[model samples]
Target: MTNTEITIHTDGSCLGNPGRGGWAATLRRYEGGKEVKKRSINGGVKHTTNNRMEMTAAIQGLKKIKKGEKAQITVYSDSRLLIQGMTDWHHKWQTNGWRKAGGKPVENRDLWEELLTVTDELNVQWEWVRGHAGDRRNEEVDAMAADAAYKAA
Candidate 1:
């Protein structure tokens, strides 16, 4: 069977550094060159940081995948922190017990761990895009996250 191709676009927003925060993800499934399914999800926390929200967007997006299925998944985000941490720092962090340089614990380690676990289960490709550009899907998710944050405020 051919591998299913799933594309998820994600974004996060925070009112303030330690204020209301929100995350959004848009999932699209393509089979045989035709789009099959699509979904959008978003949520917020009463108190959280932008980094936490960024990690939450990725985790929540990956969590939508069906279990026991081998799929080629690509996650697109604007957060360099999330993209870099997952693609580069994850291995080092794992070896260091989630600590960064100077033995400092990684922020959003909880969500990072969860994202790592979820992405490991699927063939995930991490993609970084410029934010606030003309990417419609990214813009949509950004708006969603912002609206969710607004509601939580």
Candidate 2:
């Protein structure tokens, strides 16, 4: 069976650093070089951080793929922390028992572990997009996240 191809754009918004926050993800599937299917998901919490929301977006987006489905997924996000953590820091953190430099336990370990679990079940490539710079997909998720945050407020 041929592996499916999917692109996911994710974004997060926060009204306050530790206040209302939301996350959004947009998933598009391409078949035969043509757009085939698309979906958007979003949610928010009464109190959260932007980083947490960012990671949540990624986790939610990846979860859309069914278990054991074969797919090549490219995940796009504006948060450097999310991208860097997945591509780089996660290894070191895992090696050190989920502790960061200076021996501080990794912030957002729950979300980080969830993200890792979802990613491990799929073939995923991480991409960083400059947020609010006119990337249509990225902007769409950003708006969705902001709207969700406002609604949750």
In Å, residue 66's CA in model 1 sits off its true spot by 1.5
Q: Point out the worst 10-residue segment of candidate 1 by lDDT.
A: 65-74
Output the number of the TM-score-best candidate.
2
Q: lDDT by residue for model 1 over 68-139, one digit each (tens)?
A: 557688899999999999889989998998899789998877888788788765788899999999999899
lDDT of residue 25 for candidate 2: 99
lDDT of 1 at 127: 91
Query: Clashing pairs in model 1?
Result: none
Q: After superposition, how far is residue 63 of candidate 1 from its true place, in Å?
A: 1.0
In angstroms, how far off is 128's CA in candidate 2? 0.4
CA lDDT, every prediction? Answer: 0.89, 0.92
Q: How many residue pairs clash (N, CA or C atoms closer than 3 angstroms) in each of the candidate models, in the order given?
A: 0, 0
